[model samples]
Target: MIAGREVAGFSDREIADLLAPLRPAAPDSTENATRRDAFADAVWSCLVEPGDATAGVLRLALGPAAALVALDESDAVVERRLTDAGVPDPSRLGLAAARARWAPRAVEGRLRGAFRSARVMGVRLVVAGDPEWPGGLSDLGAHGPAALWVRGDPGVLVSGPSVALVGCRAASAYGEQVAAELADGLVSRGFAVHSGGAYGIDGMAHRAALAAEGTTAAVMAGGVDRLYPAGHHDLLSRVAARGAVVSELPCGTSPSRWRFLQRNRILAALTAATVVVEAGHRSGALNTAGHAAALGRPLGVVPGPVTSPASAGCHRLLRDGGAVCVTSADDVRQLVMPTLDLGGDAGPLRLPPEQLRVLDALSSRRPRDEAAIAASSGLSAERVAGVLAVLELDGRAVEGEGGWLRGRG
Candidate 1:
């Protein structure tokens, strides 16, 4: 029993029915244990929010079923169980705080409702050991999702090589065009595209990949049962028909701002690389890029006109040496398959080390005189002047009345 309700009330027959979509061919001998574990994971998906490291630790230490039972035990017993399971420091985990956050949603009705909604919507719950699970997600460690709610062929998620194309929701025409071209080109080379199911660049990528008849998955912030951005209903439906629409949350969960931010981590972890096609200085896509870099996944960006604010984030990434400049599908392919040489250069701008330092010192919004540029870039004045001249000839920088700024190329 848990949260004033008897666990026995949720019959094994009902649990098996709810999981039928994912367990079509399970052997009878192992079905009981499999059903119990899957049901526990489903309950865990409801008890904690996305990317809850504490919950992840608990689930890993106790296993989903034993962890759920721990919620009903006294704090001392729970801590002992954690210790017995080899947790490094059980007290530091703040079980009391975790329980406080989880208590409100621990009702049996909530669990039943989630399962009911999933069964009605034909959503499949996929736990970590499932064959359909994406192996790449293991890289997230304790911050990864405990289970996934999927609405299409879960096989598409584990299919071949995948790249994430993410950017600002309010993308410009040029941004959308480049996103489509990259998506189409990557698909033709046998790569699945992944993106958030949002408007602008994400929409363009999904549409282009589908037009090329390639697999593409939309990782949503909300429940797989409720596709957010209502306008993309038909598009998302089409994606679920051919690929998958996925979320870490269970059915009936609504999308929130925090959930959207947490959702970006999953997108970064699920693919070999992430590309920021277009982003403003404050675009949320930068959040995804940060995750990719932290995970040691290759990050790529598409450069836009220097004067366009829409490309400011991409420029920032390049200038900071946080991402590689990739303008074509071949360049992206190289990122995923580093050893597969494509003959000559893939056409990314390969500036000299000194020139790149000078470019990094130049500001897009504020002009800096040669002495100031030299000081910031840690280069000699003579070298700075020469590099500035070469940059000017290449339309990479422009001198104004007082100083030089990044060019409008």
Candidate 2:
């Protein structure tokens, strides 16, 4: 159902296992001699499949296919972009049924036309053999994207143990603080921060990781290059510069509320654990937490003051036995750090006040100018600029053509 079509019998996890081998060879990965032999075998299998839409989708998704093509007006309601490679034509059966009502050339024309700009676009297609692919998401199986249009770096996907922190987009000030503090503590302990890249807690996680000069991952509902919520463009650009912004959706695609629903699944599955800093009763962050529970991933909720509506969902999670309450970064790391065994105990982590001042000027999703940093942190432009230089040297901040942003180290 996640592919916008039905695939009976096989669970998503089973499907993820089937495609697990294809990750290293992401969409843009180059084909080699061994790969050629495999491709030949896969396509032939697709072409020879007994006539059926379910088999058609499986064939396109697995091998002997380059894309699944569907005709549509805009990128959002993708009619199809099914890539099925075969020694014989795989489209004959499906096209035959639909063509009786439409034109055969029109069907073929649609596939060819979509492929035209798609090549220039370099739609990310992670073959089973690509490097830099994240196998964690393969757990989603048929529900996962046929291939991800990854922006930033694929290395970040599997670079280290990651913890996703999500919350309400309309987060309270304390919620934002928890998000930032959680991110800071996570990075300090050596876990890469991951989130949906939304406003509120998600944005704060990215910004905090940058402030800490630690790696962070931003998962998107749309194309990585497009950067939805256009307001976060600058913050996202910083993420791309420092860590990565990944998307299961292809480039040129736009986000929808429906897509956002599934996007949380990808976010939840990709990390060692998930932490909800704040959320209202219906916040998407809570949805993400539910996905984590269903997927059997560890779920943590940050406790907030009793009065805030933003923390209500978290309180509910605690009440329902859905999540464990985490009051500090130590609580989070104790639950998820063993997978990578970061050994954060080698020494005490430290950050100078000068660095903190610079970081104080940054937001989880907002950038600040030298003057702004000075005013907010109560330091002189000269003083703030000097501290920025020191922070950059320390790998805590970065200077760019646009301005300084929390560096994603």
Candidate 3:
């Protein structure tokens, strides 16, 4: 049996067996990993807390397996290894402090037990460099997760452009409705919806995406082996079926306030754009919006009633010029796919308020009667007729066998 270094008393064979189910299948590489590398990564995942920059620096320098071996060495040896690897000693904590923080937690049995529990629950780990890992996560640098605990199609995590729709947990009815409609519209337009899978707006986004048969990922604060908030268990299970339920923490790790704050970075990193559907003055969704903005990702916010306190955060984002105002999925698409020309016109298609409202009521698929259009647009029949005529002349509206509908222009 191969001797244990990080995981004392455990044989290499035992470590390999525990980690086999969680290893990512490489898409292009021909070489297989030695058992030690995989096990060391797993140990590193649970050894340090999430977003530990010092640990990230060491792993980047000495590599994960060697870093584990260096854990037991003297400060002189560790500093030499750091020098040889060209990694500067961390500023936040010295080598001794870092070792103190990591060594006590790197237990052999703890790693084994967590791996076994995850395997039993169908949870798997996707480390960095795995084909299934999201390439966007690399943008986070040292703050990124060491490995992801996933429960779903790992491909969906990075398959296409992802939009994160997040908002307050104690959401208002108006907020929930907007979140659901935005999620449904985004999915219809081929964007995967991502959320924290909490209550209120987050829950609404996930449910709407699943109802529309679109993919949605839930970036959880805790481990994938157990669902948090207890009530969202059923909803998140559906998310895992269609997209993914992912966490940076290992199995058996519980959610904390700090973890929730850190989890926001993953939601931002996984998506091309982040939209805050609704938020109060100090909502957690704003934290996510901050991360998105810091990453230079496009930020969007849905405008709510001026008087509603729940929308205070969104209004703040808009006023601060930190986010663009997005009213519909079309607006969202423009933020992500900026190169696509939505309206086929020589110049910007500026329309009167009534014409714009009527056009919004019209559908691209089925035709609607004049009366239906009038009711939907909240306009009088005479005004509707007048606007329809103006739109039709501009090649923006069409009359079909049924009645009237949207045009190709």
Which candidate tops TM-score? 1
TM-score of 1: 0.81
Better model by TM-score, 2 or 3? 3
Clashes of each: 0, 30, 0
Stretches of candidate 2 above 4 Å error?
1-127, 338-409
Global lDDT of each model?
Answer: 0.84, 0.63, 0.80
* Tens digit of per-residue lDDT, candidate 2, span 1-409: 1133212222334333333333334333433333342332222222221123433344345442222222212222222333323224434435434323323323333433332333444333343344665766655553544445455566787777789999999998899988898899989887899998898889999999999999998888876657868999999888988888877554455788877887888898888789999998899998898777766566888888888888889999887653667888887875453222345354323345455545535542456678877765667789988888887886567777667776644
lDDT of 2 at 46: 22
Q: Per-residue CA lDDT of candidate 3, range 1-409, in tens?
A: 1233324445655655666677646332323244556566677888888888877777777766777655777778777778777766533337678778987777767877788888888887787777778977887887788788898888888777789999999999999999999999988887899999999999999999999999899999998877877899999988887788999888899999999999999999988889999999999999999888776577889999999999999999887653678999988976664434765323223345467557656666778889988876668999999999988997678999999877766
Reference-based TM-score, model 2: 0.61
Worst 10 residues of 1 by lDDT: 1-10
Worst 10 residues of 2 by lDDT: 42-51
Residue 34 alpha-carbon offset, candidate 3, angstroms? 5.3
Arrange candidates, best TM-score first: 1, 3, 2
Q: How many backbone clashes does candidate 3 have?
A: 0
lDDT value, candidate 1, whole model:
0.84
